[model samples]
Target: MSDVKRIATRESYGKALVELGKLHENLVVLDADLAGATKTAMFQKEFPERHIDCGIAEGNMIGVAAGLATTGKVPFASSFAMFAAGRAFEQVRNSVGYPKLNVKIGATHAGISVGEDGATHQCNEDIALMRTIPGMVVINPSDDVEAKAAVKAAYEHEGPVYLRFGRLAVPVINDNPEYKFELGKGIVLREGTDVTIIATGLEVSESLEAAKKLEADGISAKVINIHTIKPLDEKLVIESAKETGKVVTVEEHSVIGGLGSAVCDVLSENYPVKVLKIGVNDVFGESGPALELIKKYELDADSIYKKVKAFVS
Candidate 1:
C-alpha cells in the first residue's frame, strides 16, 4: 500500500470517463458547472462536443441524461453529491430511476471529506436516497483502481446507477496485482478469526491500518472492502460475520443509512452477529481540513482501532 500512489477516487473517475469516452462513441458526459472541481473537466477537455455543461441546474441535467438514455446514449451525469442526490432527487427518481434509463449519475464530493465546504455542500445521505430507488445500483469505490473499474461497470450495466466519489486523496490499498473489481462482490483484504471489519470508501484504507494495530495487540482483525453498497455481497458479509462472531463497520457517511446500517441489516437477518457501527451519528459536518475532519469524526485508523478494541472485548 505504501508503494502505491495516493489519488482521489473522483480523479480516477474523471480519467476513467475519458478512457471510456474513447472506447464508446455514444458515451456522453454531463456536469452541473463543477467539472473542474469534480474532475469531469478531464472529459470535457477531451470531448467537448459530447460534454454538456447544464450550468448549475442539476435537476435539468438529470432530465437531459434520461432523455439521452432514451435515445440510446449512455449519459454520465456529474455534479456535487448534495445537488445531484438532494436537489435532483425528484428528477432522478422519476426520469432516470423510475424508467430504468441507462443513465449513470457520477456524484462527486460525497460525504464529510468535501471538507471546508461545510455541511450544506457535504452530502451524507446520498446512499440512503439511492438505495430507496428500485433497481438502482449504488457503488462507492475504495480506491482509484476500484473507482475506475466501477465507472466502467456502471457504463456496461443497463440501468440507473449512483457512483459516489470523494474529494480527499486516499491511499491505495488494493495494489495487489491480482486484484479485480466486481460489481457486487466484497473482498476480504485480511484474514483473521477474532473480529471482522467491514468498510467502504476511504475507510477501507483506514480499516486496513487499524487491522495492523489490532494485530500488534494480539487481536487479529479481518478487513473487508465493500465497494458496492446497494447490491451488497450478502455471502461475504454473513460468512465473515459467522467466522469472526463480531463485526465493526466503518464509513465516512452517516451511521443511519449508509454502509454500517446496510451491513447490520444483512447480519441481523442471516448470521445474527453483533455489529458496531462507527460513523457520523446523524450529525452535519463542519468546515475543517479533510484529514483533520476524519480524525475529529473518529473515522481515521486510530479511531477504528480503538472502537474495535472495545467492541471485541
Candidate 2:
C-alpha cells in the first residue's frame, strides 16, 4: 500500500502527461486550445514538437486524434468535460468507438467542481454522456495517484478511453502508486456490512470520509471506489449490495445515467437493495468554490453519511 496524499486528479494528469512524454516520443498530446486549463501545457512545454493545439475545435480535434490513433501513435486529447463529450460525441462514436481507437480523452474541469464558472462551463452530465458511448471506457479517478495510474493504463490499452478528473484538490485515499490498474476493476476502500457506498471521482474521497463517520456512528459502511464507470464491476456491486442489503451511490456527476444509474442497473438485474444516490440532482450548477458547489448539490461526505443512515435505518 502506498501512502495516500491529497491532490487533485487534474494535477496528476499534468504530471503524468509530462512523464509519459519523456518516456514515449510517439506519445502525442492534442489540446482543444485549453492546454493550461486541461493540464496538457506541461506536456507541451516538455515536448513542443509532439503537442498539438487544435484551437478550441473539439470535433475537429477528435477527428485528428482518431487519425493519429490509426497511425499507431498514442494520442491524449485534452479538453473540458462538456465540449469533449458533447461537441465530439458523433466523431468519437463513429471514429473512435466503432473502430476501438486507442485515443485517450483527458477531460478536465468536470462537474460543479468548475466552481464559479457557472452551468455552461460546469459539466455534471459528462459522465452519463460518455459512459453511454459504446467501446468507450469511462474512468473517473479519485485523486492524483489513481489518475496517474489510469493515464498509464489508458496509454497501453487499445480502445477509446474517457478519463475525467476534477479541477480542485481533494483528499487522496489510494496509497499504492505501484499498484497495477485494471480497466474495469473497482477498489474496496473500507470493509463493512451495514451499507455499501459506491463512488467515483472526487466522491470516492468523500465516500471514504462518509464511511469513517458512519463507522464512528456505529454504522459499518463498505466504501467502494468505482473508478471505472463503464464496463462496471457488476460482480463487486452485486456482492456488496447483497452483503449490505442497502447501498448508496455517489459521484460528482448527475444522478441520471452516471455512476448511480450504472450501479442501480447492475443491482436491479441482480440483487435489488434500497439505494440512496448522492449527486447533482439533474440540475446545472452556478459559480462558487468547488467544495461549496459540491455541498450545494449534496455531493459531500456528510450528505452521504446522512443518506446512508436513512437507508440503513
Candidate 3:
C-alpha cells in the first residue's frame, strides 16, 4: 500500500478544471483565496481570465457563482469544504440550489484528512449539509481518476452539483480501462456474500483492502464504491444488501447524516438489513498528521477489517 502511487483528489480537481476550461469557453472558476491549497491554482494558471478569486468571502463567492450560471457561464466555485459547504450554506441553498442553477462546487479539503487544520477546517458535516439542499447532486470521488471524471460529469449535468475532494493523497484504485464514471452510479469493486461494505471518497480503497482481509478470515465482504451520494444507486445497494444480509458503510465523514445514514435510509425502507457504520463517531477532528488521524479515527484498512470481522461473526 505504501508503494502504490497516491494523488490527492484536490490535485485531480485542478487538473480536470484545466482540461474542461480548454473545451468549454463558458467554463469559469471562482475561488475564495485558497487557490493554492485547494489546487484551483492550476486552473488559474491555465485560464487567467476565466479564474475569479473572491478574496476569502465564501458566501459571496457562492453568490457570484450563481450569478455566473444565470448568464450561461458554467461556473465552478472552489474552496475548502468547511467554507464551501458550511459557511456558504445559506447562499448555496438559496442562490444555487433553490433555483437549481447550473453551478459546480469544487469543495476540497473535506473530512478529517484536512489534518493540522483541525475541526474548524476539517468538514465532516459538508455531505450532510449539502444533502439537505433540494435538487443538489452530491458526489464524493474516491481517487484521482474518479475525481477528474466527476468534474467533467458535473459540468455536463444540468443542475447544482457538490463535489467533495480530500487533501490526503490516496491510492489510485480505479485506473483500469474498464472503469466508467456515471453521474448517479455505484461501482462494485469486489463481490462477496457475507457482508456488503459500501464506502465513499477516501474510504473506498480502504474498504477494498479490508475486504481482502475479511476474505482471508473466511468472511466474504462485498465492496462498493458510491461516488454519487444524493441520487444514490439504490438498486445496487438494495441488491447487495439482500445478497449479503449485512451491510457496513465506511466513510471519512461522520456516522451521522453521511454515507452511513444515506445507506440506512435506502435499506431501511427497502431491504431492512443490519448495518454497522465505520466513520468519525459523532466527534470533531483534532489537529494531527493526516495518516495518524485516519488511524486514530479507526478508518484505516486494518481497523475496518477488524470492525467488519466482528460485525460478521
Candidate 4:
C-alpha cells in the first residue's frame, strides 16, 4: 500500500483555531466538555484566556456564543456533532440563526466515522439540520488543508456558520498551496466527460480514488470537491451536469437533505440529469471501527468504485 499522510479534520480545526487566534484577538472558543475529543484543546492550550469550557452543556454553549457575538467577539463553539446539532437545535435556530449572530459552530466527530461511539454519537444528519437554518453558512471540509482554511473563512464571515469536521483521519487531498478555498464555490479536482463525482467531507478522497480506478477501466470521471453545502455552487453544478450528462454525489452524511439532495435540487430546476447518490441512506450509524463502518455503509473507495461502475454501465 502506498503511504499517504493522514490527519483528522478535527485536528486541523484545532490547529487552525490557534492560528486564527493569533491573527484575530477577538476570536474566542467554547467547548461543551469535548475540548480533547474535538481537538479544541490545541486552541485551549495556546489561548486559555480566550477559551471557555462549558462543562458538557451544549445548549448553554450556544447561548454563551451568541452572547459573546453581541459583544463583538467571534466565538467558535464546539461539541460533538450529535450534541451541537441535536441538543442545541432550538438554541442555534432561535439565538444564532434568528439574530444572524457572528458565531461559528465547530461540529466535530460527525458521520459514521465517530466509530465505537455507536448510533447515539455518530451524527449523520448534522448537515441537514444546519442547512435548514436561514443564513447559516454550512461547510463540510474534505481534508486537513481544506478544513484549516475553512475555519479561517468561518471566523471572517459575518453571520452564523457551521463547520463540520470528521473524527477519522483522511488523506490530504488539497495539499497544493495554490488551492484557494472560496465559500459557496466547488473545486473541480479532475475533469472528465463520462460522469461527474461531486463529493464533500471524507468522501471526497474516496471519490478521487474511485476516479483513478474508473480511468483504468476506460471510464472518464470528473471529481468536484464541494466543501460548502449551503449556498452551493449552482453555476458549477449546472455546468458540470450539462457537460458530463450524469452525476454522482458522495457524502459521509445521510442521503437526505445533504449534498446529494442539494445537487439534485439544483440540477432538476436547471439542467436535468441522472444522479446517483452515495451516502448513509437516511439510517443511523452503528458502533465499529471507522474504516469497517465505512465499508459496511458502502462509503469506502472500493464500494464507491463498484457503485459508480454499475451506474455508468
Candidate 5:
C-alpha cells in the first residue's frame, strides 16, 4: 500500500523515452507533428538528431519509421491514437506490422479522455485495430510507473508494437519502481472471492477504487490489471474467474473487442464466468470534460461497482 498520486500516462512516455534515449542512441523518436503536445519534445531536447518531427502526415511518418526500423533503429512514433490507428492504419499494417519491424508506436490521448477534443481526437477503438494486426503487440499501461515500464519492455521486444495512453492524470497505483513487470503478465492488485474485476489502462485505477468501495458494501472484489491486451494473461484471468465465479471487465476503450472482449474470450473457453462489461458502448464520445465523458460512458469506479454488484446479485 502506497500514497495515491495523480499523473498522466503520456508524461510517463516522455520521461521513459528520455531515459532510454540516453542509454541507447538507436532509440529514435518520431512525431506526426505533435511533439510539444504528445511530449516527444522532451526527447527532442535530449536527442535532437534522433528525434524526427514528421509534420501531420501520419502515413508518411509510419513509412519513415518503418524504414528507420529496417536500419536497426528503434523508432517510437508519437501521435494521438486516432490518427495513428485510424489515418495511418494501412501504412502501419503494410510496412511496420507486416514486416514485424522493431518499432514502437506510442499513441497518446487515447480513449474518451482526450477531453473537449470530441470524437475526432478521442480514440476508443485503437486497441481492437492494433490487436488484430498479425505480429503486432498491443500494450495499454495502467499508470506512470507501468507506462514507463512498458516503454522499456517495448524497447526490448522485437517487432511492431502499439502503446495507447491518455492525456488526463489518473491515480498512480504502483509505487515500487522495483515492481516486476513482464509482457503478457497480469498483476493482481487486490485479492477476493466474490468477483473479479479485470481492467487495463486508466480503468485499472478505477477498478481498484471500485474494489475498495465494494468492500465497504460487504462485497469482496478481486482486482487484476491486464496491462498487455494482445497476448493477454489468460492463465491469470482464468484462475481469477474460477475463484470468483463472476467477473467484470472494464476499460476506457470500447466494450467491443477490447479489455472486456479479451477477458470474455479467455473465460468463456476455460473458466466460464458471468461477465459484465463497462466501457464506451460502441459510440463516439462528444466534447466534454474527461471525467464527465468517463461518467457518461459508465467507465468510472462507481459504474464498475454498480455493474459488478448487479452481476453478483
Candidate 6:
C-alpha cells in the first residue's frame, strides 16, 4: 500500500478544475477564502479572472454560484465540507437545490480524514445533508482518478451537484484502462458470494483490502465501490444483495444517514437483508492524526476485516 501511487481527492479536484476551465469558457469557480486549503488555488492561479473569492462567507459563496449558474456559467462553489455543506445548508438547499440550478459544489476535506481539524471541521454528515435535497446529486469519489472523472461528470450533468472530496492521500485503485466511470453507477471491485461490502469515498480502498483478508479466512466477500450516494445504483446494490444474502456498508461517515443508511433504504424496500454498517459509530471525532482516527473509528482495513469476519461468522 505504501508503494502505491497516492493522491488526495482534493488535489484532483483542483487539477480537474484547471482542465475543465481550459475547455469551458463559461466555467467559473467560487471559493470561501480557503482556496489554498481546498486546492481550488490551482484553478485561481490559472484563471484568476474566472475564480471568485467569496471571503469566508460560504452561504454568500453559494448564492453567488447560484447566480452564476442562471447566467449560463457552470459555477463550482469550492470550500471545505464543513463550511460548504454544513454552514451553507440553507443557501445550498433553497438557492441551488430548490431551483435546481447548475451549481457544482466541490467540497473538500470531508470525513474523519480531516485529521487534526477535529470533529467540527471533519464533516461526516455532508452526504446525508446533500442527499435530502430534492434534486441534488451527491457524489463521493474514491480516489484521484475517480475524483477527476467525477468533477468532469458534475460539469456535464445539469442540476445541483454536491461532490465530496477528502484531504487524505489515498491509493489510486481505478487506474486501469478498463475502468470507466458513470454517474449513478457502482463498480464491482471484487466478486464473491458470502457477503457484499458496499463502500464509498476513501472507504472503498479499505473495503477492498478487508475483502482480501476475509478471503484468507475462507470468507467470500464481494466489494462494490459506490461513488454516487443519491440516485444510488439501486440495481447493482439489489443484485449484489440477492447474491450474497448478507451485506456490509463501509463509509468514512456517520452510520446514521450516510452511505450505510442509503444502502439500508434500498435493501429494506426491495430486498431485506442483515447489514452491518462500518463507519463513525455516532461519535464526534477528536483531534488526532487522520490515519489513527480512522483506525480508532474502525474504518481502517484491519478493523473492517475484523468486523466483517465477526459479522459473517
What TM-score do all the candidates reach, one by one?
Answer: 0.98, 0.96, 0.99, 0.99, 0.97, 0.99
Off by over 4 Å in 6: none
Q: List per-prediction Cα lDDT, in the order shown.
A: 0.93, 0.87, 0.95, 0.95, 0.91, 0.95
Candidate 3 clash pair list: none
User: For model 1, how does the per-residue alpha-carbon lDDT over 48-102 read when each residue is reduced to its tens digit?
Assistant: 9999999999999999999999999999999999999999999999998888999
Per-residue lDDT tens digits for candidate 3, residues 204-223, read 99999999888889998999
| Per-candidate clash tally | 0, 3, 0, 0, 0, 0
| Tens-place lDDT digits, model 5, residues 1-313 | 2366888999999999999999998999999889988899999998899999999999999999999999999999989999999899999999998888888999999999999999889899999899889988899999998999999999999998899878999888887755778999999999999999889999998888889989999999999999999899999998888898888888999889898888888888887868898899978889999999888888888888888888888
RMSD of 3: 0.6
| 215 Cα displacement, candidate 4 (Å) | 0.8
Worst 10 residues of 3 by lDDT: 207-216
What is candidate 4's lDDT per residue for 58-157, written digit by digit as tens?
9999999999999999999999999999999999999999999999999999999999999999999989999899999999999999999999999878
Model 4 residue 303 CA deviation in Å: 0.7
Model 4 steric clash pairs: none
Error of 3 at 39 (Å): 1.0
> What is the C-alpha lDDT profile of model 6 across 1-313, one tens digit per residue?
8899999999999999999999999999999999999899999999999999999899999999999999999999999999999999999999999899999999999999999999899998888899999989999999999999999999999899999999999999999999999999999999999999999999999999999999999999999999999889999999999999999999999899999999999999999999999888888888899999999888999999999999999
1-313, model 2: which lDDT tens digit per residue? 1354577788899899889788987799999989888888988898899999999799999999999999989999889898898788888888888888899999999889899888998988888888778888999998888899899988888788999978888886676655556889998878997888899988888888888888888999998988889889999999998898988899888899899999988888889878888888878789898888788788888888888887788
Q: State the lDDT at 295 in candidate 5.
A: 87
Candidate 5 worst ten-residue window by lDDT? 1-10
Candidate 6 lDDT: 0.95
